[model samples]
Target: MLVTEKSPIVIVGCADDNYSMPLATTMSSVIANVSSQRQVVICIIADKITQANKNKILKSLKKPNVIIEWLIPDYAKLTNAIISRHITIASYYRILIPELLPEKYQKAIYLDSDVIVKANIEKLWDTEIADNYVLAVRDMDIDATYVSSSKGLQNYQQLGIAPDCKYFNGGVLVINVEKWRRDNLSQEIINYISNNQQYIRWHDQDAMNAVIAGKWSELDPRWNSQAVIHSYSSWKETSLTEEMYNNVINDSYIVHFSSSAKPWKLGCKHPNRMLFFQYIDLTAWAGWRITFIRKLWLKVKDMMKKKGISFSQA
Candidate 1:
């Protein structure tokens, strides 16, 4: 909250009404870990978020030396966007940061709503961009096998992406906003989203990988430690050895919940789910737990689906 002469560490997140609480959790965890010496400003690409939710976020994440700014973008083509119900219009808001943000910010970190910073954020913020379009960690969930076996390599080749390039998880990105502007990358991403739905499978994530393949640099996996239920199966999927993956998980600076099954929802089953609640308990929405009814309902649904027995048919 101190708007001093110190260069602020800019961080951004995208959220709608349902996601604001998780977004606040992400912000609070980061704010709690960041050293007081670091002047930070938090930016949210808010989409149809309620005033009540904004108040809740402020109440939860109130802190000095950190400023929260909201940007409500008019996505005039919202209806035209080929978006899945789960992936809201706000998800694409991140791709427009270079143009949407003030020209003063040369760089910033874009985090997803379902992540929490465990270690000091300056470890990520102060990292050198290495002159790439963006700096990101290799997706732990997106394995070499999937990339090689699925239509992934074919799709990348079709889209002119290099075959040898890595597919990054878009949960955390150290964006070079100045370079994005200089190269007119925002417009390019917008155009890709508008006209290239056939090629984009993971919404803007696929678009980003395709648009800037081999143009981005890698960071330590500890920076964006993803996967909700990581195990030996997860290690088999990635390029990492068992020992290496364990080190990454143990030393993760940012813990990212990248899957659709979130910590707040009933029957999440992930070990990291409670980690999300640790920060949420600190928020205005404390004592909020998943209802037993919801848990029982989800269990029944999962059982029926696994057994291939629909309720209607039964």
Candidate 2:
């Protein structure tokens, strides 16, 4: 069965003046595609959002199934603070809004801005978490257990996490909002980061991993197939083809772009990255014949102005 309010899928991202318009466009397109026949809510967390940005986002979103909201203390202050440059504050903005999310929505699927959702997100929303605290997928590259013992992770032992619990990635999370609030998980995550600011590498993800290390349920890797070397190397070496994607349509829920080679960036070899275009014409995101032409014009102008190259070019 297709996912609906009974199984709402929520996507979260942070944006500001500094954020890439393409990334937000991509996210909005993905949200619009997945929520076509169901109730889907896409929340963009930012210190403040501008009217211009709102119009751009709405224009890019081609599907009426998606609902976009700017999670802020007050919409009036959105013009004051820039979000992308302030990662920590952006994080706080996301953390602050769970209380405001519908009481009916006890759980949500949170994805980072860098991902490309290739399939119906409803499948992921429909996943049975059973009695797990929260559901998450482990990082394909960095073994949290190993990385935790490496340099800068000396605090791992102090946090009381079992050594074998495996440090998981927080980029894609199935959050149990009520449980998180009831257990004070968000506060614990914030406080833990505040207390140990120096030892962490990733900002909110690391702190969240520590807070819910052993507590979370291990989700299927396909739900969050990281795009790092380890995961990519494995995929490239396998004999898997488009047949795999076709056959596992229902079983495979999300295609997580959790590595350096994002679809928006150069040299993204992951097969699923191409799937993003199917939901929305990636090149036509800005309402042009081809996205690349618009991109080329922007790049040349930027280059003439001495602006650095973008990841899409590099």
Candidate 3:
């Protein structure tokens, strides 16, 4: 039976000139994987969007058990507001986590657009934050002190965060809505950015790390496991065995391709990118036909590049 209470997952992603359809397909795949009893509220923010674009977005989001909210940042002057506050790109995601969430749910999981869901998300929703804290996935890439070094220890010192608190990646977070409301963390965060705009490097991620460091519970890496260039290379060399890859696809609650190589791009070599196409069940044969042709082109280009390489001559 599908768990209904505490089962809704909230996510936020932006639309740009380059990619929206693929992102929509990714979101649809996410909705399909979750239990039918669960609800997904997605906030899509865009600037100077057109009617055609809006129609395209709506078509992609017309999924079962999904609620789509269109947020025009320019309509509310949020774009200007954000820049005036000197918010960084990383901070954008953090800022929206609270604002875009449904008021009814006390908790919600935030996911970046560059991800696909492979397992049911009820497992993540069921995790308890007994310490009255939120949960975040650890950044497997950077050093633990990178965020702390960017901002002085004294800044976080005021937020009740330890000087040596574990730095987390905000890409996937299980936020405590009640704590956020009680502490007024959302406004406080925006206020801090407005005040100390010059001191930030990574925008909201930096601010979030500065504030929510020790306060957050670390989630299992399996939940995120974003495929980056180095990890992809290492896997190709040896580390990512077939069994491991299959386990990641079958068992992972979410698969985030959070790097430069988006699946829609020309040379997306990540193993998980392949899995992304697997779950994207195109309702029409024409759509499937286009995707297959694209895949074939990618394979041919890859072969040509390999054949043309001069490793021995070099």
My TM-score estimates for the predictions, one after another, are: 0.87, 0.72, 0.70
TM-score of 1: 0.87
Model 3 Cα shift for residue 208 (angstroms): 0.9
Could you tell which candidate, 1 or 2, scores higher by lDDT? Answer: 1
Better by TM-score, candidate 2 or 1: 1
Give per-residue lDDT, candidate 3, residue 90: 28
- Give the per-residue lDDT of model 1 (tens digit) for 143-235: 432334353433765675556678778899999888988999877777877777666667777778777878898888888877632754656
Candidate 2 per-residue lDDT, tens place, 1-314, comes to 22344554676676654343544645755665474677667777664455665666666654567677666554432222222322435544444445656666677777766566666777677777655557886665543433364521457788776566666666667777767767766567667766777666666667677777667887666666565523433344432344443332334555666655545544567767765555345433443233576557645744654544322221
Worst 10 residues of 2 by lDDT: 77-86
**Sort order, lDDT high to low:** 1, 3, 2
- Model 3 regions lying over 4 Å from their true place: 1-7, 17-19, 72-93, 100-102, 131-133, 142-163, 229-251, 279-314
Which residue pairs in candidate 2 collide? 48-78, 283-291
Q: What is the lDDT of residue 15 in candidate 3?
A: 54
Alpha-carbon runs more than 4 Å astray in model 2: 1-7, 20-23, 26-35, 73-94, 145-153, 229-252, 265-273, 276-284, 287-314
Cα lDDT for residue 85, candidate 2: 21
For all candidates in order, the CA lDDT equals: 0.76, 0.58, 0.60
- Going through the candidates in order, what is the number of backbone clashes in each? 3, 2, 1
Per-residue error for 250 in candidate 1, Å, reads 2.1
